[model samples]
Target: MKAISLFSGGGGMDFAARSLGIDVLFANDVIPETELTFASSFPETDFHLEDIRQISKFPSVDLVTGGYPCQSFSLGGNRNPANDPRTFLFKEFARVVDTVKPKYFVAENVSGLKSIQDGNWLKLQLDTYNEIAGVGYNIATAVVNARDYGVPQRRKRVIIVGVRKDLGVYYHFPKPTHAKPDIAAKKGLLPYASHGEAIRHLPLDVPGEYYERPHDPEGNFSWYYMSRNRKASWLEPSYTIVANFRHTTLHPASPTMKLLWSNLADGWKQKWEFSSEYEHLLHDPTLPVLEKPRRLSWREAALIQTFPEGYEPAGKLEKKFEQIGNAVPPMLMRAILQQIVSGEGLLQFPSEHEQYLTVGKQLSLLSEEQDIEPIES
Candidate 1:
């Protein structure tokens, strides 16, 4: 199968597609740093450094895959649920699908997209792409966690799959290949990959020939960031890695922040303090004080995201973190694409036409309920 990749940050999806023998004809992203990283990694692909709305033509292929920008709908960002221009970018995705008419299309976004504006945004997105090129598509959406797919981060994302109606196939998402240790034996699955296991062998203090050096923010933590525990145990998966380097998960070697107390009157406002176990070292002039708590290095973040070994992201430190955080974990993408191509999780629909009609009706009612309308582009 051939594919065209949009919003292709650091080629994570492209990497997975290639691993599965899917020929990616073209990849595009507006960020110059992403272009540098993607081109270096996928020199054979036609990498376009331009906005998606500016590009009017796309190569025809069997599949189209992209994890479009999700900031406006993400819980991490300002949720302008009603009229954020970025919110309408999915229409461009639909436009491409309509133009190329691929056999299948996969769109991914933050899990927060479902609850934005009480799901009106998701409904409008689905209704927009429900029927393209007149043949229509049987779309299925599911929320998947990266840990379940062997990635050492507990990141959750919404995966949307669409099969052209003429194919008459119901796409079933891939089941979890891994589970928490306690339930793994019962479910006959492998144990979840641990944060320690992912980066235990890498150099911690100094930069090696292949991996970058570890570093943390230089100043005090923000009130918003300090409100919750940022440290994960070595035995568990790391927290979600955000695009901003300053907000990435803390290294597990450091003690978890101590929660002093919570005030019930002010929305349960809490106070957090750094562990004082190492404070004695600060007082001793002869002994070396411990370095401040550091975040996962750029290479460490990529490792936890399951990027291939030795895959170096191009550009400065900030850009590297952004690309890695924004990327779809290759392992997660591979699991889904494998199921789509192999029909391993294929399901049979009793009445395909009726199902399609029902989906359309639900989307319509959802639009009416929320009184939220999609912006015209």
Candidate 2:
């Protein structure tokens, strides 16, 4: 199989495609840093370093894969899907698929799209893809957690797959290969990967390995960041890696933050700070700072996202963080592709498509302890 990757950041999907013996003929991204990183790693691909809207030509291929920008529909953002221009980027994805007429195309975004406007936005997006030129497509969507696919982070995203109607492909999202400890034992699945497993091998003090540099302790940790616990222990998966390295999850060695008070008048608000036991150490000149609430380095973030240790994204610190945070975990994409190539998903008609959308309990962004209701398709 072959593919053209759009909105390709550091070629995460391209990396997975190559691993599965799928040839990636063309890749596109507007960010120069991403192009530099992508070019270094994938010298064989024809990469376009320009806006997606300006690019008009593409090679014919079997697949089109992209994870369009998610801020427009992200829970952490304004959540204004009704008027946000970014939310309509999927139409550009559909346009490319229509032009290439690929047998398969997969689009991914933050799972928040399912809840925006009560899933109507998702429904409309689905209809747009299904109406593509010729015989149209058989569309299926699912919300999957990165932890379930062997990534050491708890990132969740919605995946939409379209199979051309003429192909009569029997498609379903892949079954998870990993699960929580208790759930894995009962289901005979692998235990979830932990943050330690991803970054423990990297020597923190190594001078030459530039990627090992940690976030400055003096960097701002906004009130919003401290609103909940950001520390993931050695045995747990790291929190979602955002584009801003400063706001990334705290190192596993750092103490969990403590919420001291809360107010729910205008909106849910809370006051949090370093744990009582650890607070004294910050001001004590006699004691050595115990990691001092440092954010994960770009390399550590990359590892938790399941990128190869040797795969260094191009450019400065902030750019690297942006690429790594925005990337779709390669392992997650590999699982999806494996299922598609193996033809192992159960067969079903369009009416039963909703059953294939695997919705599960998700960790709320507001508080690590809160369990928000998942939107059903």
Highest lDDT: which candidate? 1
Per-candidate RMSD, Å: 7.5, 6.3
Per-residue CA lDDT of candidate 1, range 1-377, in tens?
A: 99999999988898889999999998889888987887778888888899898999888899999999899988879898556777788988999999899999899998877677777777788888875768888887766788888888898887778888888887777767787776788767888888766887777674431222336442456545677567776767899877888787776655457777878588856677777454323434343222566667888888888898898888887888889999999988999899877877556662232133455354333222121111111
Give me the runs in candidate 2 sitting further than 4 Å from their true place.
Answer: 205-220, 259-290, 346-377
Residues 1-377, model 2: lDDT tens digits: 99999999977788889999999999998899988897789999999998888888999999999999889888888988767887788888989998999988888888888777667677777778867879777776767888877889898888888877788764677767787788778778888897765787775543332222348452346566776567776667888988876677776655657777878575766666776355424444343234555667778788888888788999988888889889999998998888777767535554243332322211112122221122111
Error of 1 at 347 (Å): 3.8
lDDT of 2: 0.75
Tell me the number of clashing residue pairs for each predicted model.
Answer: 0, 0
User: After superposition, which runs of candidate 1 have C-alpha atoms over 4 Å from their true positions?
Assistant: 206-220, 260-271, 276-292, 350-357, 360-377
Q: Quote the lDDT for 300 in model 1.
A: 83
Taken over the whole model, the C-alpha lDDT of each candidate is: 0.76, 0.75
The TM-score of predicted model 1 comes to 0.84
